[model samples]
Target: MNIFILEDDYHQQGRMENLLYQLQEKHALSVKRLEVYSKTELLLQAVQEKGSHQLFFLDIEIKGDPLRGLEAANSIRQRDSQALIVFVTTHSEFMPLTFRYQISALDYIDKPLDKENFEARVEAAVLYAQKQNRKTVADTAFSFKSKYQQFQIPYEDIYFLETSQISHHVILYTQTERIELFTSMNEVLKQESRLHKCHRSYALNPKNVVRIDKMERIAHFPNGMTCLIARTKMKETLAKMGGEIE
Candidate 1:
């Protein structure tokens, strides 16, 4: 997660930095980049080139301009509607303007910041950002065609694909469902690179695999489901998984 702070006060900036560092040390927050900008122009420039999963903490008043932070946040929302925005200011009266601007501010933190309240709001924002990241990943779908229908399943929900007993068909195993599709293993492989042929009968999604048993040559999924891993493919699969074998 990328975090951006727009605060003109030096003391407030130091306080936020300290609290964020403590959160990082305690493993309560995962931050890729932490940037502090006293100027709104610079902050907006960074927002224009922003990456995924961003969190912004803006002070409503910047250099006597009361509405500067709100304007900056509006620009951010225009660029990335999903980015998390939080207002940190003493001007509680301006809270209504957030709704008027349609910025969707995540939380409002009062200035002269309270340690306990600050930590709690920051932690909440971290959790929300993590959830949004998971949702984005889960939204990616694997598209394929069945005998009579076309299927699009979220990549995160899929466990594996195996050859069905019936000829020219394969069974797609998901977290809650199993779908029999008239597709070959070769064709399935072509659909998504994430689906690897771990065995002659099984093409498992390594991302959804909970564990790999080297001795048993089995792949365990989250839904108490299991699939075989071929001896010939075990070494290659282990390599792909960075040798995290049991």
Candidate 2:
């Protein structure tokens, strides 16, 4: 749970850092907290360079541009839809304006901030982010981006994979979805060698495959899908999948 605080005031910066450290030490919290810049370039770098941040503590009002904080946040959300954004402001008036930026301002603490409310909100945000991480599909937690958004296709959901063109890819079939994963066959085999390379270009996830027809040189799955096993690679695939399954 990494937290990036984008507040410019020196005194307020110290206070936020202190609060974050206290929570992590006393609560056994998992966090990588930092105070980011008020400058636009620095703020942009803060949001882009990280793998994933659990929350953004943004001050609605900063020095140079009154709306720069919101601008930085908008950019951050474009890349990561899941990151939590909580505006720290000195007035309730900004509440109405927060929506214009399309941010899910979880719960902003108004100026003359209440100690109890501040603590409660931070605690809630941390717990919520942790919950979301736990709920994501575990079978294939690894994900990639599409034109619309990022999607994860679990390794277990892969019906079968194939390799070619000096690059490897997986033809992933899930309950109600079909996906093409951008990965190399060699990489997949290296990760899970249990996958049977039934052909020069195919790697079958045995769990989804129901049977192999040697006469037809094919593998049949319970879902009525079939894959041809090249004779050249049949012997190797057999040795890996075993002659029979229990």
Candidate 3:
């Protein structure tokens, strides 16, 4: 996971990096990017550009401005509600301000920087972030490996899958792209329950079906893309769709 530290003190900044590296060496944590920002604006800019779940360590005071860190935390919450935020400060009294600002901080670590306590809190935060990531991937993503590439796509983005003319290949269609997979419809169906085999060659996501034409035996999706629906399976498909046809 990405990690961001907002601290103006050069010594504390170095110490934080050293501890993170030590944690990595001990196999206690994994970091994709470790960045330190002395200013709140820089930190928020990075957050907006990165646009992913991250771990944040914010000092309660930046350049002697007492409320700067809390303001930064509030901005980060507005941008990414799932971010794990930990306050690193000597001002434990300011803890109550977190609730007032509605910043759902993950943890608070006091900053005379006790080595043992710091490591423990950092490790726990890393573990929590990893657990959250796994849960999100399991709930919303579809994973598959083809001969050329592996893909993990969000379920809502996928529109349909169809057998390709090439042997043992299937074409996966999404809102923005189409991919060829080295797999069969049976294997795909086993992985995702949202897809239903509407025809011999096509399995479509009922959620993405914008209109169904019983007369033409067609299922229409976004962008005017259409998939064939077998006459025999039409009744079953319609039933699965709660009989909502347009």
Best by lDDT: 3
What TM-score, to 2 decimals, does candidate 1 have?
0.55
Ranking by TM-score: 3, 2, 1
Clashing pairs in 3: none
Per-candidate count of clashing residue pairs (backbone under 3 Å): 0, 5, 0
Tens digits of per-residue lDDT, candidate 3, 137-167, equal 5777665543444455667778889999998
- In order, candidate lDDTs are 0.81, 0.65, 0.81
TM-score of each: 0.55, 0.57, 0.61
lDDT of 1 by residue, 1-246 (tens): 678999999999998888777767776666667889999999988653322367899999999999999999999887665678989898999999999999999899887566787778877776777677656545676656434444555677789999999988899898877777777888878867888899999998888877899899999988799999999999887876677757
Task: Name the lDDT of candidate 3.
Answer: 0.81
Q: Show where candidate 3 strays beyond 4 Å.
A: 28-30, 48-52, 140-240
Where model 1 places Cα greater than 4 Å from the true spot, the runs are 48-52, 140-246
**Cα-lDDT of candidate 1:** 0.81
Model with the higher lDDT, candidate 1 or 2: 1
- Pairs that collide in candidate 1 are none
